[model samples]
Target: MRFPKILLIPVLTLLITACQTGYHLTNQGYSRVQVDSLAASADSGMARFLQPYNQQLGQTMNEVLVESAVPLNKARPESALNNLLADAMLQYGQQKLGQPVDCSHLNYGGIRTNLPQGPIRIGNIYEVMPFDNQLTLLTLKGSMLREFFEYFIGNQAEENALIVGGVRVTIKNNLLTSIEFTNGKTFDPNQNYTVLVSDYIANRGGGTAFLKDAVRRQDFPVTIRDVFIDYFRQLGKSGKPINPTTDGRITIQ
Candidate 1:
């Protein structure tokens, strides 16, 4: 069947323009909004329609990563991805500092989103931590360190704030013990320990009341985002197998 070429051109153009226009509506002459009631209704609507999909998407991504990558012995799939990221930060810090940094900490809330499944991407990391928090090194006395551990245990359930990098610790009967590092090293109280943790951790935001009393603290010139990006790039360059599993970095005894 022969088609009318002239009529088809005009019809196609109108269809394209209509699709481009979309369905956006502008309210003419906006006045004061008594939106407290409307806000509540909108929140409830979102909870009903959007919350389930978001949770499902997170779970799906987690599963995809598991299926796509060779599982590592050190990964902790049950815990949040923030802990895994904190471990990477600590590893990078140890390489640069020329000494074993006691721990690396990142706030649970700071990890805004879950890691996507399948191939890991830099954009996913950005979505997880949208903030510009930088890495900070802090030195605290032995007593202050003990207090820091105490603070961690106190709010362990309430806030997922502190993730110990380069170290493994257990809380037993509300007491901290059985400390170890990724390289099977233990902490020395007398030695001046360098901690590679977030600036927020040094500021005591993660239930650490004693962080304010740190003896020596300095913020590194680089942002945490830069650290993660570099880590990912280096992994690609070295062809080192990337595993998203968690070792016994943070544990409950």
Candidate 2:
């Protein structure tokens, strides 16, 4: 194609301008929309299509499982929520693995929220434990158990890093004075104990270096939240509220 100088210059300029570039808005701001009490239907056909899924999810999330007579909050040294969760893990692990669950450890951060002293729902469990971490039954030697406790006491002091079940730890001046089971059996450093822990700890997610030397480990089919839900149901069937007490499991002096 033949073109004049002015025509060629303009054509080249148009070709250069055709290059794609992203828009970088310097004054970006959020736009708020009021969905409630809106004047218009605002896509009613789409809403109809999503109505079934919304109904199913709402029903599942709202079903009351049990009542929490006491608020299950996370605390350093110990907590009622921690006690309830740890007990549930131990019970579930013991029954599922067909073995004596000597102790269980629930990562303090893993419990995302606290259970209010009221009706506990399926959604409440989901909110408290919102992870896919499964139940891991680990067979640890007595030495490993000691290391676990030491790591728990030293590193987990601030957030109370781990809430334990089955074992009681008495701390004096920030030192472990006595180590015994919640039932009064003393810990033996030379013996092997089966404990229930989350796969998050077993997989080294939350600074659980103590669990690295586990002698034997068994992974369960369910998750921590599932165990809680199942236990909640079981207790509800027996008319027991979801109330667990801090029975000096982690005594501080």
Candidate 3:
């Protein structure tokens, strides 16, 4: 659901108008407008027309989806929010692909905000993951997977780290000392494993060129946001509050 930033204005306007007027928006045609040249002042008539729609949209966004037993914050190495998101991706990927996903990873930059300790709302999830990045599955030889972790460790920074799931990574002196699955199986260089990640990474975005070497790739139509939303809804229906915590999944020493 990625859209050019410039097109967002017109697309949002069409959505709001459709909601208010009961007229579906369609691809009629297109025209280029100099957005920078437009006047800064808000149009009074347009604002009045959009007020109700804005309120409705806001209400929908604010609807509570679930509750969190503890506040989840994103951080380097590991964090509660990171673990929750990565686990959700892993679970969703396995369910969607109808196969086991050895692991899951997400770029730290993709998560935009933190979740509060109480009720989690739809808008909160939207704020956390604004970009509609699709989930992708990659199958790689154990050797390539090891190389990927080495690169990930070498590039670690406060704002640049990968949120990981189903694996424990130990780093020493900025080197990946050891990596093993949570199930207690050590990494084997000859094995093939499936990893769940965002399409952005699969396409070699975020400077991860090695991802292009994946032995096999599968792109799912579902977005990461959709995955989280459904996960939260299921928890809500089951009257269970998410209580994610930071384990030693990724330890730096």
Candidate 4:
């Protein structure tokens, strides 16, 4: 999908006080401090001293990359942030397994923060997806998938619905009246499909014990947070912003 136009904005810089100990300001007048070019030589002593640590830190965590055109958060049956997270995991897991991803299921509570519309920082990702949850691929039959949806529909009042992608559902009066894959094909009961899930739910089973019966459980090396961060970074290279909308995949009527 095409993202919104990319925009570059200046990073917010914080004012720092260089006092050795905590000091109370007696005067209210503004004071400026020199933060750069203190040394005349290109290879200054201070630069050399800090070079090793700075190089070690690298550009992985602090880089101001990726842009969000709209704020996304977990709302209810579906949310934009939840969609992106689920979609990101599904896409990444599929690539790792070299197979089609039929569905992705993650708990809404797993989503920690709203993705705001602005410069997406690696720090923001750390805040948003602050978990070491590993990704696991499972082979669940189509009937099990239906049973999974039923579990959610039966108890929609108490627990959060699974943040899902690659499938569409129509929940009417808490009953799943219609269901289909994103390709508009009905889930075949006899067919076994690749499912992506977080280690948390898969290990203990989800809202129901049906997930425990999934075949061919495979654990991946990377965390779910990295999958999301990597996807955001890839989108940054393509000039894509976080601009997902409600696709009506989970219609509540």
What clash pairs does model 4 have? none
Report the C-alpha lDDT of model 4 over 1-253, residue by residue, as the tens digit: 6434452222212123333457797877766765665633366787889988887676656786688888767788787887888888888877765766788877776778887788888878888879899988878887887777667666656665757888888887777777788755667888888778888877864455667788678887789888888888888896767677888778888
- Quantify how close model 2 is to the true structure by its C-alpha RMSD in Å: 5.3
lDDT of 4 at 171: 82
Score each candidate by Cα lDDT: 0.64, 0.81, 0.84, 0.76
Assess candidate 1 and give its lDDT.
0.64
lDDT of 1 by residue, 1-253 (tens): 7659978889898889988946766766757756686465666776789988988777644421222144222122125365567767887787865545777766655767665445556666566667788888888765566567666566646644345666667766666776565665556665556677778777676567667778888788777876876665666565444555555556665
Could you give me the TM-score of model 4 versus the true structure?
Answer: 0.72
Model 3: per-residue lDDT, tens digit, 160-181?
7857888888888766778789
Error of 2 at 238 (Å): 2.7
Q: Count the backbone clashes (under 3 Å) in each candidate.
A: 8, 0, 0, 0
Off by over 4 Å in 2: 1-43, 157-160, 182-185, 240-243
The CA lDDT at 62 in model 3 is: 88
lDDT score of residue 12 within candidate 3: 97
lDDT of 2 by residue, 95-213 (tens): 86677788999888788888888898999999999888998888888877777766767776456455888988887655677778765566788888887888888887657766777
What's the TM-score of each model vs. the native?
0.62, 0.79, 0.77, 0.72
Using lDDT as the measure, the top candidate is 3
